[model samples]
Target: MPDNFNFEAAPFDTLSEYERNLLRSALSVGYYVPGETLIEPGSTTLALYIVLKGVVEERGKDDQLFAHYGPDDLFDVRGLFAGQTRHAYRAVEESIVYELNAKMFHELCERNAPFASYFQASLAAKRQLARRDGQNLAEFILTRIAREHLLPAVEVSADLSLGEAARTQLEVGADALLVRLEGGFEGLGIVTRTDLMAAHFQRRLSDDTPVGTLAHQPLAVVELGDFLFDAMILMTRQRIERVVVRQGSQPVGLLHLTQVLSLFSTHSHVLALRIARAETLDELQRAAETLDTLIATLEGNGIRLRFIMQLVSALNEQLLARVFEQSVPAAFRSRCCLVVMGSEGRGEQLLKTDQDNALIHADDISSEDALTWMAHFNEALKGFGYPQCPGGVMASNALWCKSVSEWRHELQTAAQEGRPEQLLRLSILMDAYPVAGNEHWFSSIQAQLSTWSDQGERWLSDMALAALQFDTPLTLFGGLKTSGERLDIKRGGLFPIVHGARILALRKGLMVRGTLARLQVLGKHGVLDQHMADNLAETFELFVQLRLSQQLAGDRSGLRQGLDVSRLSRAERDLLRFSLHVVKKFKQTLGRQFHLDTR
Candidate 1:
């Protein structure tokens, strides 16, 4: 038995002697020291390193110290099968580490079901972190107790003023600079040339303003040791043009938009432009398909799933807007509104889920021709890859293709006295995003929805409660039960979290599409407490990661690419269980938050 003891004993401790013997035969010495590079980021590291003594500090080249590894913590196991190169492993002090390569590690786990069981939560947690688009590398590492490459970044204070920052940018010719704290980029911020220009155009700040004053809080960051591919995805997803690269929390270098893009498509900007200018239906379809290819390429290159979804959604929005411009008649077009509902609304359109949409035209007399033209445009989307929604919520459905007066009336009526079935079916409509047409129509809808009264809340609460009713697949043993077979990860696991969040957010009068986003809005307003919100959001992100992973798998296998209920790991089951608990709390919270319990 090892002398080092875990405060929370892992399942490994429960293995039978024979199982331990099977595991022990291939075991390398359990070892590690502090302040050493245990597994450098970017190398192919396929092994489990057991720490025998000394704490290993997980430091990114950016100088960000994330997690501290203690005895018995498993390191690099994800890398063993992740197919991605090792990331961020320079120890903080002298340490000894036992490295078990893939084959031996597999045998040991195969020999001990308990040891393999221990892996479920670890894998689920890592994959969830990986799929979160904008979480800093430090945040990512802290959770793993495991993994940076330093990137180029500039150090600036958060107290700096926009104008002062602008002067520094002009002098240095830097498009952006990173705000820094003594420990690292934790408090670091980025100031871009555009930010400077915007500062110049907008009034109300002095020249002597501190350079740090203009720093946007939590300026997104990249560690020096991170893969360029990861950095590129973050830049795109967060819509930032540059990232501060740091070494061990020190701003060592700066990575620009150009450098980040080099790792993505040959030129996303060029493709975006081409998509914007494409005129005909055939050209738009081709552009949309090209977007799929771009996403597939990005996915293949190990770009994070959240980032892929962001780019695909952005590309789609641009393409559809162009199509709207081309198809809608010019005169009435200015008064109409086109929107995307459902997953696209949440910015979570992984692998082309069906289109959930509706259109709003002007209140005044409209031509049947215009409606007909709109119907034709909806058909065009099918060729472009958005399947006609099975529920018939698209603009082509006469019930949904209404004038502004009709839409406002419908929403008000729904709020005042809509049927539960209607609310359930039309929840997506409430989250509609205006891709094109009348901006005013969107604003009107948004305002009315936000001001929804007690009656509205009741409808929303019931809808939310209904949505939250999905039983989390967690068993009484806190385990996920499958048919002793692979489970449909989506049905059993993800949809519960997502749909629950959706109903609650709506009940709270929130319009944000992403669950993470909805939680942010709701949490701020006291609808969800901080811990519950964080857990709910994390659970949803976990669901997205798993569901998307399966979709990618099915894509590779040439399957239909719908949600798969099976094929989850044990760790994922744990996460899903955690998520269900989160939902239970949410359901309880929803009852309280909306006065359902009191009622």
Candidate 2:
């Protein structure tokens, strides 16, 4: 290796002899002159690069500049990732880069599990950013704003030539570059590998061709104050590969399309797709068994608990749809919607949880035969491993399976009157998320939801009153509250966040379906700040993982000791304890925001 040649780009500090030899053999090392274009804007190169020296710049083109990156930051990863190039890159100074050809990178990762694991996550993050807009917009209006969503900006003014830009992208292994424009922050534009290719094809163009000529303007930006859904929308509508994430003018992060979607992929995608393809109920069960294996894999890999819930939510929705498809009549299926309650509704489900579901059917055309078919549908889902809804929320329960008019009346009556039965009815039903069929039915009911938002201050008061139904298990001494021997992470940590997010969202006319989603939207309205909402979202996620690990371990070890609060590893216990405080603080925030009567 040449002097000053080092591999800070590698994720780990020390490498085994075999790995070092692999890197040495497979790697092509080179030094870039200052102002040499490392990668042309718009040219998609299927290679990963490691920077050994000097600064590299990543700028967004066409109004959605991503975060600027430097030494130790991997770039052009998407080239290594499924071989798609999205951004433009350049080096700010003379730089040295290790060009790990795509084929070599794949081989190295495949041979080394530790390296492969990190590589998988890195690639997954990119893919997620590519596919985030698939979510229903209306349903996401209430999600939490996350710190990760911040657009990253570096404060520097180094104008490198197009040649240098290309070289830098290759050096940092980045897919794109976002250059700082002289005017406003959003005035920043980006250049991609595609642009570089365009430059390459134009033989008249010189390495000295001012990259700024090709720099697209108006980097797409969402404020730190913007809701997460807004970020989702910007990504979805723009159709570009990444977003210029920002907090005011300063870039704090890059919201890569691939990274966002990776959050919901993994096991859930596997289960959902497999279950969809299965033809028989028995086949569905076999596919679902794959979930157990998936869970074990997830636990072994050590992903956070909150992310697991996202996987579970995606999987549950997928599994439910498959079950409904196999059992429900095609014509009637579109006329009905599946509603999940309890933990599933609150986005806190962990492990394989019990079912809390209800169905809503169109009122005008139901016959006894229709009822029979719906009943069979419910039973089919149960057999496929989603236990039937407790408390009769299942479609088989006549009280719960009502027509559109009936459902509206029930919610309106519950809100207007404030009786024990009505409160219980609304409480059980409010968190409903429609999974399959004529979402129009759910949308119709959603229109009515606003009816209470403006006029029903009393109803808001009542819901806030009922919100206290779920409690944080914080004890008198200010430590975590215990339920018998094991701490009830769900009630103590998760529920408070869910309920607070829910009540705040509902009171604000935010009709989002998930807790984090709700907090996200509310944050945009100044109802909750970004950090406040994200902390609560994190709290809910941590509790879920703790409880889920306990549940999964219980089934495997037969040690129903529950989660040993004290026995937890230091990291796990610390995260849980911190999350506990997050939930506690969030509950108080909700009460203050809603102005609920303490009495």
- Write candidate 1's Cα lDDT for 406-514 as tens digits: 7678777887776876676557665678888777887787767666644576676667555445555555434444555444445555565566667766656676767
Model 1 TM-score, 2 decimals: 0.60
Score every model by TM-score. Answer: 0.60, 0.55
lDDT of 1: 0.63
lDDT (tens digit, per residue) of candidate 2 on 1-599: 43333533234323566776776776777688766667766676756876667766665577344543444446676656656656566677888787777887787777766566555543223222222232443223335556654334433233667888888777765566777657677567787768877887865578877677777777777665565545544553444556666665576656665665554333344455566678888888888777767666665455544454555566667677777787678878887876777777765565555667777778875746446766887777667666665566666777767788888888777666777777666655657777777788888877776555665556665666555566666554344456565776655665567766766766676777777677778777888877777666655555555566666766642225345675564335435555666676776776675676465
Report lDDT (Cα) of residue 2, candidate 1.
Answer: 35
Output the worst ten-in-a-row residue range by lDDT, candidate 1: 141-150
